[model samples]
Target: MISKISSQRTRCKSWLLGGLFCAVACVAQSQAAGVTWSSQYQDRLFDSGGGVLDTQFSFEVGIFLPGFTPTASNVDLWESNWRTLDRAYDPTPEDPNDGDPEGWNVPEQFFVGYYQIEAGGYSSSPDADPLYAFPGGAQAYLWVYDSKSLDAPREWALLTDGITADNLADAWVVPDADAGSLEWYLEDLDVVIYGGGNDLQGPGGYTLDPVVFSLQTHSVAVPVPEPGSALLVGLTLGLAALLRRRGLSAARG
Candidate 1:
């Protein structure tokens, strides 16, 4: 009789312990999926660049989608806005004090910025679009630049044909590595919905946007839980130890 009672208690303990772990796992997954890609974001009143109404941002690495970049560079690598260095832009030696413009021969200017979209990062749009409407069957475009090239190639390489909208569009980036360290950036995103054109530019075709997506002053800033993850880890461990102790007591009795 004692043995049977002990076995039953052990089973009960096992069930409870399993449930605790399961609860934690489920909570973590949901948090991950529902969590906004940007650690913080803000809504723009007037769409200036790429007609973006909302811009997303995050300091953490996973803010972007998977496969976007197996490895990503920090924010310092963002190369956002710059015109080509040409005759019109060339500096004249009119001022003898002016330094040498020879160094300006590089292909493009570099700025490191995270991914962003016009609409808010959600299945349902909470932010209003003042400039353009978000159309159906919008296509995704990936732009990757070579930071180490001698000319710093003006061209951006394509990463994919088309990507589905899972509410986390514009959540990827391409890293520019230099001397085994990441230098500049190219964003691998899927938020720009190009509907006017056919092909991938159509509802679900693959094509690159000829235009650039610019950031505004009103972008959303969604802060992530800095302490919650660690707390959850502690709770999980505590519960596990408690359950184990109870099981041992039951077995001995």
Candidate 2:
């Protein structure tokens, strides 16, 4: 009789502990997917090289849909105006005195989609033309620091065709053994409109407006926890202890 009662009590204790663990697991899963991404647009306005805007620019990034076609209205995210590099863009100079041009700013923020603009043609109209239609597709480019220091690059011009919006989304820089933090930068990206150089230069004298996309900083995706995982671990440990105790009890009997 005593053995049967003790066995029942052990089973009951295990059930109660397992139930409590499951409850805690349920709470963790709810928090992960429910949390949404948000941009701090309200705090800062889009600042173009020329000037800054009154209102904030809207933008977002999420799981890219399969065969996702980006439109102005259906834009998953938006970037603010471009930020111009204030200092002169002199990567290298023959003489020490020869400094970069003053008040020269390059567009850093505001990246355009793959087909947002034509290579040689003019105008990236967000309203009139919703999609950026590049006939032959386009290549994204940016100017990065030749050397680690911000002062200047040893080479004259260093173009970056590597970094893209899609790449940046999943991009991360890890600290290496030698160097502390490798420099991560996005130079200007190009969207190929028409193939030829003449097409880039419009009919009369109209200079094609650069279709630029912004390099906005974004948050990383967090892993969703499995509700049952923690509980399984706890239960496995408890079961092992219970089995050992049962064996001991039998031996005593």
Work out the TM-score per prediction: 0.21, 0.24
| lDDT of each candidate versus the true structure | 0.29, 0.28
Model 1 over residues 1-253: C-alpha lDDT tens digits? 9999999999999999999999988754343112122111221111222232211111112112322331112212222211111111113424423332421111222122222222222122122223323232232232222221223212122223233344234323221111111211122233322121111221212133423232121111222345989899999999999999999999999
> Compared with the true structure, what per-residue lDDT tens digits does model 2 show for residues 35-133?
111112222212212132211222211111234432223211211211111112322333323332221122222212111122322113332132322
Residue 81 local lDDT, model 1: 16
Model 2 bad stretches (over 4 Å): 1-4, 7-11, 14-49, 71-253
The residue ranges of model 1 lying beyond 4 angstroms of the native Cα positions read: 34-153, 156-253
